[model samples]
Target: MHLYDGHFGGMHLIWWIIWVILLAWIFFIPADIPYQKTIKDSPLDILKKRYAKGEISKEDYEESKRILNSDN
Candidate 1:
């Protein structure tokens, strides 16, 4: 049995394939860049959230709602 008969060709091919896959993985990975924008809630949506969290009284909520609706 000649151990070196096909070792060079087979191992060289496998190493090349593994190196290509490693390079692709390094370049294609996901990143959260600093310039990426975050979604912002609207004024009315913020008001609704505050009311739901008990930060505003019902009277205040209704008053604010009326004012906001009138503005539109």
Candidate 2:
């Protein structure tokens, strides 16, 4: 009877350890994490990027920038 009780106690301890390890893994492990890309630019910065990328010529860039800054 004593040996049986001791074995049961050991099993309880093992169960608790397993439970804690599972909880820690769930909290610590980042699963299915989303990918995010950051843009650190304002509208003006975006305009500059477009100009730099040759999407707009120098003359067109300046004209567009002026238009953006001007109030309707």
Winning candidate number (lDDT): 1
Error of 2 at 61 (Å): 0.3
Q: Extract clashing residue pairs from model 1.
A: none
Q: Worst ten-residue run, lDDT, model 1?
A: 1-10
Candidate 1 similarity to native, TM-score:
0.51
Compose the digit string of candidate 2's lDDT tens values, residues 5-63: 66677887899999999999999887765676555786778999999999989998898
lDDT of 1 at 58: 91
Model 1 alpha-carbon drift over 4 Å, by segment:
1-32
Superposing all C-alpha atoms, what RMSD in Å does each candidate have to the true structure?
A: 6.0, 7.0
Candidate 1's error at 54, in angstroms? 0.4
lDDT (C-alpha, whole model) for all candidates: 0.90, 0.84
| Pairs with backbone N, CA or C atoms under 3 Å apart (clashes), candidate 2 | none
